[model samples]
Target: MDEESRNGGPDSRQFDVSGAKINILSDEYDPTVSLISSNEKWVEDDEVPRKEVGTSSFWQATSNTVALLLGTGMLALPYAVMLGGWSSLALLAFFAIMFCYTGCLLGSCMKENPLLTTYQEIAGSALGLRGRILFTIFFYVEVLANRVGFLISVGDNLARIFPGVESHIPAWIHLSPSMTLASLAMLLISPTALIRDLSNIAYLSFGGIVTSLVVVGAVAWTGTTVVGFNQPIPFANFGKWRFILGLYSYCYAGHPVVPNIHSSMREPSKFPVMLMLSFTIATTTYAGIGLMGASMFGKETLSQITLNIPRDLMAATIVLWTTVLTPLTKFPLAVAPIATELESFLPFDSHSTAHYVFGNIIRLGILGLILAVTITFPYFGSTLNFIGSSITIITCIILPCVFDLVLHWRTIPKLQLMVDIVFLTAATCFAIVGTFSSGGV
Candidate 1:
């Protein structure tokens, strides 16, 4: 049963925040409470208890975030190798440090301000509401585009393997239509329903992690046979470490989800450990698969390439469909929040939850935009690099630390600013290089 049907009324929970009853409601329990002034903060006043952080569990959270990213992009890992060769691992290590650093800083902010749900809230706290909304919107736009590309790319691999139902339809129609339908169906469902609790889906994450290991293991076994350990390395402007850093940045963009995960964590301090483990797992996962792909396919074949390098159709199809499953699940959940936020201007009566969910055509419209972007910008590698680098640099890397330093400038020690300056400087360099390299210059 849904939260409404189960509770039979608005579900809420009261937290004593400075002697005020902060009644948080909804099945999703994502508190909509916002501070209007020092004397007033608005929270929904329903009789129902607040839903616990069940859907965003540590294992599942770790797995889903890692899996969705690893699936589509890890397929492109070989291309990174193709671009800069084995030495690229140096840049990868550098990014690992930065990833953990940013994750820790973001986590600290979340711990300090537990109510800060959106990165927009974090930004808005210092940069004003408009700035917060703009950055959040820009970040969401990139995420949506990336999600679309992920589905299309998965379809591309599936097409290479399945070929067709009857093997009679034209390539363009056959490919795009089926994938679009699959994406649409996934989006139309309520993520709130699919995962009422994370523990319910914890098995899915464990299953996904095992599947990833099996798939990558299979690839490693095959790739090792063909290319061995000593594959040819490229010298594509070796001096351009900045662009290389940008490429590595794309492979590790799950830092934003840290806040969502931290909110659920039993011992939030363990969050840094979890985040690091997640990144390490992701890095090793992608590097292994990328190495396998490059060993088997070489630079020319692997660039803008996919996971369809398998000779066995059955194996390839299974990997293609299953690898993208988590990303497919993430699409609707991520999109719903955007739609809900647009609820304020929605031309409908204020009190209809059904209308808010169903009446909005804007969600479908956003999906259409995603499809258009994937078709027009068919080259996935550079597009992924550029978007991932630029947006993540701003949203994940630069923004939080900047906000912390700026808003709490006087309270913060001088050492903190120096550290942020170094990171910001590094990120700027990476963004510049990533943009140019993505342009094929």
Candidate 2:
């Protein structure tokens, strides 16, 4: 290949894909020069630097990473375990470890070539232009669907909180609990979505973490006390384990964003430490919340653990409010990527008034479509399953392992290659089986 094609030219930006740095010079194709040179633009435009004066400290990065990992997924764990049984914990543990490992692989790719900023960029690097396009398509579909799921979640919680309102609202108004909450959510998110700077909404990301903690804490306490854990502690039946494993895997759906998070770290080498700490905390919390809810409520455990709890007004209010507010805060951040990508295609100066006006209109239109989807088909489980089977597995497991092997084929040890093959095969199988089990396929 010509130098320009190999190095990605001047416009080519690289971010760290692998957690560890790779010495690409030894290879027939030298990736180091292009990777390093292209990173300059990304470093300048990255959200982290715009949000703050400098790269984030370990703790700051940790907080954000943890917040990203901990979310509405926690609420569904109990139901996952209820379906997969206790065996699901083993699957959860396995997936968590693999998730972190694959994350490290992405990090290593970044380390080798710190310029690769987005998942799409990394995919492009690994599999060339085709890979980039494929990843972007999946990324858009997965995230849009996820956003719809978030709307559904917010609406569901709101319905629970105000069960009476749904009854009172006229049928002619077509204001079911789901529709009403989704409409309100879209309204709340529109203004935030219009803004160009993601840094402005940094504070809102914490809402997911705070709300998650409250829900987990409430579930743990209530599970032990009011519910009186009469259900089996380590309940296991392998029959429907695939279904449960799929949901559990869905909980660790933070891999796509890891490179961005890693790039923002002040100490990039320590990114693995940050990854482990965040995953450990998130996984433990998920386990505790899921197990407790399942042990207490048993077969009765609902998709959201809070729903199964003895209805104390205060608890219900707090849980439900957080559910709404958490996603409320996350809506902008979640949709920002989509808006940014869509905005890029418009032929207008980003700084121009026309751009801002048009951008917001497009963003609102996107949100309107998502809201419509939620209203039309408000099934959260199917969305979760689809994401888990498709993007989650591809981004988290298959792509990472495959990229590592492909990028460093000659240098990496045979044993490591074998392991990657095993993991890739197994994870692919899981994705397929999980999809079928979850009725996604």
Candidate 3:
């Protein structure tokens, strides 16, 4: 049930700020909230109807956040650790702390401007329409590319399950790995993609987290028992250190979804605790997987840790297929924001049949586009690198720090402002070097 329905009318408010209540009858309502003028500013926006009503809890939010951060990104960590050597482990820990800082900035921004639920909204509020446009362009590029990468993974693993299953067909079939896998991805992800209410799919997100844990456990077991240890790489490879920063940045790529998860929680203030819990679990999993995979396989670690598993082992197949399933579950939630942002621009009645019809149309259209990209260029690692270097940096480190500085420029202490400036400078340099290195230029 929606907040309005539960509260008996649009006039009812979930949070009381300044003893004022704003009524938001529907999703189409404008989000204009009155702000408190005091030092500790607060937003009282009623139009941004409570997401998930009473169903969303702290643990659910944490699990979903884990599900988002723990997918495909972790798969590449073993390779990232290999690239940067053992020092990459230290870098991962340091970045995890930095990530938590930026995440809190995002949360604080959302609290100050409660009307802002989406990144585009936050960008527009801070930097105007052009900023919104800039953020939107970058967001869609990153999201679509990430989804395409997921589809490619699905296709590749499905092909692996039935090796030579394609060759049994006649000559005219002409099914390459990309083609076969792309078709399979569409078939697998379409049902989840059609889900409009993200709260309903929370279980799927929970399952994804569990699946990732299983995969991690399986990889750790295989890395310890089955895989033979080889001479380890150096502590840090200065030559390719840029690539490690980008890949590790990708491994912590959950900042973009902070607002969405924050908005869904029963109490937004608890978001920081949730973020801390989720990131702790995520970093532990990442360090263990990366260190174990790199230590066992050494220089021969594949880009995906699962690939290092001996194929004949049942654990290998399970991890491969779980890798496929986790992404399929995550693809929908990742793309929902893009669809929601697009829908706000079109002329469709929220209560009419056209809105329902058109919403699915947009969702399916996105799936179709991802499928086409997977078929056209099924390369996954390069795509991952590009996303890590480009949008991931923007959403994770750069934008949040910039936004916080702009939002609290005068209110925050000079020391805090200087710290943000330092963060922005360091992250920007990291992004630039990572981008160039990832492109092999």
lDDT of candidate 3 over 1-441, digit per residue (tens): 254533434232111111111121221211121111111112235754333322357887777677667767787888888888877688788778778889888888878766676555677778887877776577667768777777777777777776776767567855685467668668776877777555455445445566778778888778667775554867888677776677778777756456656666776789899999988999999988888888888888777777777889989888888887767776776666566656555597766788878888887888888878777766666567767877788888899898888889889888878878888888898888877777541
Better of 2 and 3 by lDDT: 2
Question: How well is each residue in 1-441 modelled by candidate 2, as lDDT tens digits?
Answer: 234533444322222111111211111111231111112222235344221112667887677677767776788888888777866788899888889888888888878775565465678788998887777667667667777768888887877877787777766787677679678768876888776555455545445667888998777777655777689745676777766655777788867667767766667789899899988998999888887888888877777776676666467678878777777765665566566667767798867888888888888888898898888777676667666776788778998898898788988878878878988998999888877776631
Off by over 4 Å in 2: 1-60, 114-118, 173-175, 346-358
Q: Residues 210-319, candidate 1: write the lDDT tens digits.
A: 55665686666555554354566564547645444555777667554455556555556677777778888888877777666665667554443445345464555566
- Which regions of candidate 1 are displaced past 4 Å? 1-71, 113-118, 164-211, 224-230, 235-246, 304-308, 324-326, 350-360
The alpha-carbon lDDT assigned to residue 325 of candidate 2 equals 77
Best by TM-score: 2
- Global fold similarity of model 3 (TM-score): 0.77
Candidate with more favorable, higher lDDT: 1 or 2 = 2
- In terms of lDDT, which candidate is strongest? 2
Whichever of 2 and 3 has more TM-score, that candidate is 2
Return the candidate ranking by lDDT, descending.
2, 3, 1
Candidate 2: worst-modelled 10 consecutive residues by lDDT: 18-27
- lDDT score, candidate 1: 0.56
**lDDT, candidate 3, at 174:** 59
Model 2's C-alpha root-mean-square deviation from the true structure amounts to: 7.3
